[model samples]
Target: MLSGCVLAGWLVSGLPALAAFKLCNQSYDVLNIAIAQPGPEQAAADDFVTRGWWRVAPNQCATLVREPLKTRFLYVFATDVFGKEALSGAIPLCVGTRRFVIERQGDCLLRGFLDARFLEVDTTDQSDWTVFVSPRPS
Candidate 1:
């Protein structure tokens, strides 16, 4: 039989690492953050859902998704504290000026909303992922 200490060590080593999705702000100015991930009810009728508005202060970090990541892809959008665009990408995603959860991406103006470029992050199906938001270089 294995000793108590040996058994404990083995068990600990066999356990999986903590899984989470986190955002880190590495800029001087405060940032307004948003995220989009897979949504429930993926029936033929209902489709993917995306939500946002997680504010992150300068030199801070926020946990966007506390549980283990369920999707391989994630979308992100962020702006400065002054409502000026800070970071964006070519991928277009439906977003609002205020806190919102869009069911799908399309026709922002018709839906009474604005369009924002959401950067896509590929997590490679990892259980944990962290995204760092940095200011544009002068």
Candidate 2:
């Protein structure tokens, strides 16, 4: 079960304004980015932007909107914080007008393979992601 597919590495190469940006699963896999954050919406309200790059179907794969968190997920090497981005982009946090408070828990990394069998997911597999969340500036 853990040795069938290779967890595709997603490279978010797009406009940086998309703070809460989501990447397309290159290998057409759907996995939960179990965000170890606060509660809900804080991440989106602060630095979350959605990036739509699903090449299969509009309803295929998972997007930020579908993420357990209400923001976009970016892939990093280890630990890297997102700084102030000064670009003009409109990556809506919600599809309509449901403003969600992004969840911010660990100001470090999000480790743990989401259970696929128990959770109905897009990338229904065991994939681990590293979320580099930095401290909010005072």
lDDT by residue for model 2 (1-138), tens: 111222333335555332232333232223223222223454443343222222222123333433333323332111111211211122212111122223222221232211111111222222322122222233
> 14 in model 1: Cα distance from truth in Å?
14
The C-alpha stretches of model 2 lying farther than 4 A from their native spots are 1-16, 29-36, 40-138
lDDT of 2 at 89: 22
Query: RMSD of each candidate?
Result: 11.6, 16.7
Q: Which candidate is the best by TM-score?
A: 1
lDDT over C-alpha atoms for residue 34 of model 1:
74
Q: Tell me the whole-model lDDT of each prediction, alpha carbons only.
A: 0.69, 0.25
Model 1 lDDT-worst window of ten: 1-10
21-123 per-residue lDDT for model 1 (tens digits): 7877877777788777656765522244657777888779888888888888877777777877666666676777788888866677888877877777888
Error of 1 at 88 (Å): 1.1
